[model samples]
Target: MFTDEEFEKYLKELDNPDLSEFEFFTESTGVKVYRRYNKTSGLYDYKTIGGIDVPVDTCFAVYTDLEYRKKWDSYVKELYQFEEDGKKGVYWRVAFPFPLSNRDYVFVRETREFDLNGKHIYVCLGRSAEFKSKKEKSGVVRVNDFLQSMIFTSDGNGTKAFMHYYDNPRGMIPTWLINWAAKSGIPGFLAKMVIACNSYDKYLASKK
Candidate 1:
């Protein structure tokens, strides 16, 4: 279990990651994703940092709204709150392309909001969790090794976002595919998110 203070400390570290160790993977629009190998874990870790042309609140809402996720996140086949408390849940049947088994995650997610340097910052932390209600679904592989965190800071007329993600989907996946997904897939997802945010903002404006 990670405390809020610990999460905060980790988030700060991600902000100033040792760029010397991380190699550039890909960039889409303004988002840049990087990849590095962790010798200790024998797994690849990814970091992404970029600015989106949307308010911090809007960007944060787009990320946390479960119901709205399916509209923008193409890979999310199903998502629902399994536990009553809503903090612990399952991401069911995330779609991977042909020849790769679908994957799912059971995670505990927490969010914190604070102000730093006169800017509002929101941090979301998620880690894999074992829950009694979670069970492997047919044709979908359960992802047990997953840790993800996202930080969004209010920038002038937009939001600056940072993400650190690590996951090991145990299967017979090619190293080239894994590298491609980390490089191309993530930035594409973020680009779609920016479009979603803009559309949502227009929807909100129309209601006014």
Candidate 2:
């Protein structure tokens, strides 16, 4: 069967097709952002927050700690535990828009770039049991898959955050229906993420 991307391309061959997503990556000042949305596309693409930045420890702290996450983002129900990769990561759970739906995700420092001010990248390095809940088996998780990357970079002002979300969850419902719901809901959720990040950025800047 033809993949969604392949079908999209095929349709484009027949006639002009409206792009579901545009400008997969964004750049501003000392920050460059990347993101991807297709279920099977194992890449990162998205927007980055522009303007004054924050410190690496501060930013990472916000992401790794679920309690800290609630101050900034609005989607996490709980963070069960956090463990690092030889002292460079933490594991946690992030809730989705749907009920009893959450993802088992992990975060580990990937690399630090010396250019463009300074850059820090943390990816979803692993997952323990990506289950739907305590009542389910370790079947293919249908909430959020792996391949998500979260990056933080700095500039003369401070540091900017870049979010790279990946995953195409499969479950009882069809992917198309889930994609449709996500298409309708993700923008608002993303807006919340941006707002939370910016608010935290402001709080951090004030501390300096």
Candidate 3:
């Protein structure tokens, strides 16, 4: 779904060392969050870095397994994969607190493995996509603008992970919700991911 030049651009941004444009948002659950303004969207983009004491493969699996994600992620109201015209896509519906409408997204995702400088890295890239066969549900806002990239690499006995995320959840959003996303939402999700990674082997065995 992405061109080679576009992928290279993403890699360049991931490799960028200039943190002067970003401000530290929070640090919790072994993850540090940073944010920078996106002039194009008039919103903020997030950068997250952390280490999990799990194998790199396990961590990557936990992040990519949609079935397993439904078990660990409470915010995931619905998630599944589909194929149309020989292309694969993902649909996700996120649950919001009371009185607020839920949000959904359709994405085209790709995963790549690279050996750079003798270090093995796994990257997951995703962007919003339009699928003619997918229909939107009533009362749920469709998030058409979303981008995410995750990088996982071995760090000694553990895995070092980084994420870059941006999305425009089109609709009316309150200040409190925005604050919660930055402070509690992201870290809480990562914390649950760690737990999921720990049990991923058992989960896989159950499937066999």
Candidate 4:
């Protein structure tokens, strides 16, 4: 569980990451991805910055609405929440491309809102969690190492999004393949998110 101060620290880090050790990876449209090596974990940490031409609240809604996620998140083969405790839960999933084994995560996610420099900001943090009731499923690789944070700030026109993600699949995958996917995958995901938010906004408007 992250305290309010820790969450605030994360937000500060997102706004100003120590780029000295990070290397530029790739960019698509307005999204840019960066990667840094973690000596302790022996894995790479990924960060992405991008702007979506949608309201901040809309973006947050699209992200947290798990039921609505299936429509836009093409990689999610299956997802369901279990053992919910407020914003925390064990979410099942089958992700990654074909030929690779599916992966599942037992994680706790929390969201908080605050004002930063007169702009409304929403922060969502997620990390792996363990429980006695949770167990790994058959034919799926359980992701034991995972941490993700998404910060959305309302700009005058739209929203600016920053994503910090770190995960290890715990398998015999090549580093090059993982790097390739991270570079290409994140921007595409952001693009899809923008489109999905727009679609959802239209859907809401039409109902009025």
Clashes of each: 0, 9, 0, 0
Which lDDT tens digits does candidate 4 get at residues 1-208? 7898868876886568656778988888877888998776567898888778899889999988887787678778776676744444757576767678889888888889988777788899989988656688887899988988999987678888888899888777876677677776788778898899989966667658
Candidate 3 CA-lDDT value: 0.84
Angstrom error of the Cα, residue 40, model 4: value is 5.3
Model 3 misplaced regions, further than 4 Å? 9-20
- Taken over the whole model, the C-alpha lDDT of each candidate is 0.79, 0.44, 0.84, 0.81
Top-TM-score candidate index: 3
Give the range where candidate 2 is weakest over 10 consecutive residues by summed lDDT: 10-19
By how many angstroms RMSD does model 2 differ from the true structure?
10.3
Residue 59's C-alpha lDDT in candidate 4? Answer: 93
Q: List residue ranges in candidate 1 displaced over 4 A.
A: 11-15, 18-20, 40-42, 84-87, 202-208
lDDT (Cα, 0-100) at 55 in candidate 1:
89
Range of the 10 consecutive residues with the lowest summed lDDT in candidate 3: 9-18
lDDT score at residue 63, model 3, on the 0-100 scale: 93
2 against 4, candidate with superior lDDT? 4
- Model 4, residue 102: what's the lDDT? 89
Candidate 3: lDDT of 29?
65
Which window of ten consecutive residues has the lowest lDDT sum in model 1? Answer: 84-93
